[model samples]
Target chain A: MKVQVLYFAWLRERIGQGREVVETEAATVADLVAELRAREERYDLAFSDMGAIRCAVDQALAPVETPLDGVREVAFFPPMTGG
Target chain B: MSEADFDLGAEAARLEAGEETGAVVTFTGRVRGGGGLRRMVIEHYPGMTERALTEIAGEAARRWPLSGTMIYHRHGSLAPGDRIMMVATASRHREAAFAAASFLMDYLKSRAPFWKKEETDDGADWVAARDADEAALERWNE
Candidate 1:
């Protein structure tokens, strides 16, 4: 399945791109993260500290363990700092 | 992302238009100037941001007897002292108006997809989410 993946804030800066489409067979977000981390040094570094990252599947906040059965979009970013 | 300033007076007037609007509460947040700050830049997920903000406003209306509600947030480059965002809630009584406005603010602070970065004389850094902001939501949970 192909999913539109988004990065924001420092994550986008570190990853060098704000958006990308990835074709993956990973069932869960964690699995997908692992696959991306293995791609290059940049992905590995960007995703190194999961504690500082947040994920939203299909525009709704979700856990990293969430399964991507029919998900079309996923976003990763640092915690929001809006007001 | 909009760099335009929001019209607070107009928004307040709109909220208070209805006859039942006995009270209207408005909250505006401005960028603080200090520590040699140069500017602030806000980034947000386009599609998710609209959805989140709408959901939050709807939730506030459902939780209280609000006659009307308005939420306006600005993105892109912003200077210190610029109005970043505003919320207005109208109700039959002051209590409901106040509570709904506070609820909207708390939810917007953490739940919205917007991220802010502070650019200073030394360097630029993404603003960290405060523990207090997360804890503010706890009081609203039933």
Candidate 2:
């Protein structure tokens, strides 16, 4: 499936890219993350600690086990600090 | 009435308009200057920020018999003493209003997609997440 990935805050800085389009064969969010983490050194560093990153599928907060079927967008960021 | 803006007086007036609401809880978050933070700038993921906040407000409404709710968050450049955001919940009793308002703010602090950049005398850095925020969200665990 084709998915748009977004990184925010420190994740963006570490990865050196704010957003990207990835075509992955993974069926779950965790699977996709694993695939991305293996693609490059920066990806590995950015996603090294899963506990520090939060995921949202199509703008809704999702657990790591959430399925990615039909998901067009997946955003990864550090936990938000908004008011 | 459910709306988000940057005006405090209008929100206070709206909260006081209803006779059924005996309590109004308001929370104003401001930029803290003393906490190793020199200058603060807030950035939001435009559409996503609004969606998350609307969902939070809807959830608060569903959880309480609130007379009204108003959320105001400022975007763009901000410095110390600047108002960052505010949440107001009006209900029939103080307890419900206060609890709901606090719940909403806690949820927003961790769930919403807003980023802050703190410029210190040394350099500019993005704000880091705190463990306290995660603990705050745990209060609403099912």
Candidate 3:
């Protein structure tokens, strides 16, 4: 399976890229994060603390345990400071 | 164009256009000039932003007796004193209009997909989400 993963704010800066397509069998968002961390040191550093991150799957706010079975995109960022 | 572009009077006029509108509630968020702040940059999830805002606004209307609701948020680089965003709610009574407007602002502040970064005299830094903003949503229980 392939998934499009996105990063925002400092997460985008730390990971050095905004988005990418990855081939994986990951079932949940947590699993996807682990896969990215295993790919490079920068990923490990950016995802060093899971507590510091929030995620949205398919553009909807979702938890780390959310299944990505039919999801097309997953985004990771820090807590929103909007409005 | 910058802060001078938007006209609050025009927006209020539009919001008050409804025939049965008896109360028009509006709130404007502005950039503070103190703390040596120079400018603020806002970034958002492009595809999800409009959807989130619409959902939020829709929910506000459903919860109150509002005749109309308006939200306008500016993106990209903004200097101090620039208007960050505005929310207006119209209803037959002042209570519903005020409550709905407040609810929209609270949700927009914490739930919206936008992120703000501040550029100060010292350096540029991202603004962290405030605990108060989260606490503000507790009353809604939505």
lDDT of 1: 0.95
For every prediction, compared with the true complex, DockQ reads: 0.93, 0.70, 0.83
RMSD of each: 0.9, 2.8, 1.9
Q: What share of the true interface contacts does each candidate keep?
A: 0.90, 0.81, 0.79
Sorted on DockQ, best first, the list reads 1, 3, 2
TM-score of candidate 3 versus the correct structure, residues matched by position: 0.95
The order by descending lDDT is 1, 3, 2
The segments of candidate 2 whose C-alpha lies over 4 angstroms from its true place after superposition are: B1-5
TM-score of 1: 0.98
Comparing candidate 1 with candidate 3, which one achieves the higher DockQ? 1
Expressed as tens digits, the lDDT of each residue in A1-83 for candidate 1 is 99999999999999999999999999999999999999999999999999999999999999999999999999999999999
Candidate 1 wrong stretches, greater than 4 Å = none
Compute the lDDT of residue A78 as modeled in candidate 3.
91
- In candidate 3, what are the lDDT values of residues A1-83, reduced to their tens digit? 88999999899989998999989899999998998999999999999998888999999999999998989999999988877
Per-residue alpha-carbon lDDT of candidate 1 for residues B55-130, written as tens digits (9 for 90 to 100): 9999998999999998999999999999999999999999999999999999999999999999999999999999
TM-score of chain B of each: 0.97, 0.91, 0.94
lDDT of 1 at A54: 99
